[model samples]
Target: MAYGLSEEEAVSSISLSPCEIMGIEKDYGSIEKGKKASFFVSKGNALDMMTNQVTLISIDGVVQSTSNFQYELYLKYRKKDTTN
Candidate 1:
């Protein structure tokens, strides 16, 4: 069996390999020809950046806003709590 389900599956149960998903098996899901840039780099686990802080995030070559919704709310309440 070329595929099954396990921790190594990496969320492939409903789909083909990353190369197939992106439709660039020969040029993408790796470094090669005219492949649009994708993916991200985080200070720690990439997923953690969603809850933690993200130094930077670029999607489709455009940088994302650094303003974090949760962090902003925390700051808003933290200031209120301290003042109170």
Candidate 2:
């Protein structure tokens, strides 16, 4: 995941580096520490653009919303109109 990203871009591109820099990294990004834990729970490989499906989610020791978590919702509802 830390492959093609520049320093600042990498930090800003994902919710990890910044969280770490702010000393909150222990409680966020990847699996570690006393963090409550959260996950997209994709059905397929996270690197595969075509197979990415965030089927389940957990946030802040709880599950808030699955079908409307912004990114997942976009992937779920925003299909390109190829009817033409």
Candidate 3:
């Protein structure tokens, strides 16, 4: 974005553009028939670190768990009364 690319182009630079360079655009970049259904769902803008919150992810047309060790630990610890 700082380089003057539009929001769409900036997003493509990280998604479609890379796949095109890797010669995997035919099966990886851009959602289309016959292409791999791999992507993530975020609650907010994916480009903004502060607002980016990935809630779901799918790979090769399969939904995946978003839970991880860190997230599990956060949930466990956050449930405790730290003020005590």
Candidate 4:
């Protein structure tokens, strides 16, 4: 956005534009019928790391678990140490 691109353009540059440049737009890029359904749902602007909290993800039309090993470890360690 600092480069003057709108939010939509910024997003497209990373998503749709790349696929189109790679000649895979027919199967990737912007969501459409018959196209591969793969994307992540974020709580806020995906362009902003501070606000881009991914809550869900889908790949080839299948929902995937968002929790990863690091996230799981964080969750486990975030609890107060009862044995202390």
- Model 1: CA > 4 A from native: 1-16, 22-28, 31-33, 47-53, 81-84
Off by over 4 Å in 3: none
Tens-digit per-residue lDDT, 1-84, candidate 2: 468766556535466766777777777865666776865677876556689777778888687565556878688767878677
Pick the winner on lDDT between candidates 2 and 4: 4
Best by TM-score: 3
Better of 2 and 3 by lDDT: 3
Candidate 1 C-alpha lDDT tens digits along 1-84:
134446346434322376787776654354345764544555754333355455775655677777779989988887765552
Off by over 4 Å in 4: 82-84
Local distance difference test, each candidate: 0.55, 0.69, 0.91, 0.91
Give residue 82's error in model 1 in angstroms: 3.0
Q: What is the lDDT of residue 62 in candidate 3?
A: 97
Error of 4 at 18 (Å): 0.6
**Sliding window of 10 residues with minimal summed lDDT for model 4:** 75-84
Task: Sort the candidates on TM-score, descending order.
Answer: 3, 4, 2, 1
Q: Write out the backbone clash pairs for model 1.
A: none
lDDT of 2 at 63: 70
Tens-digit lDDT track for model 4 on 40-70?
9999988998899999999888999988899
lDDT of 3 at 24: 94
If scored against the real structure, what TM-score would every candidate get?
0.47, 0.53, 0.90, 0.88
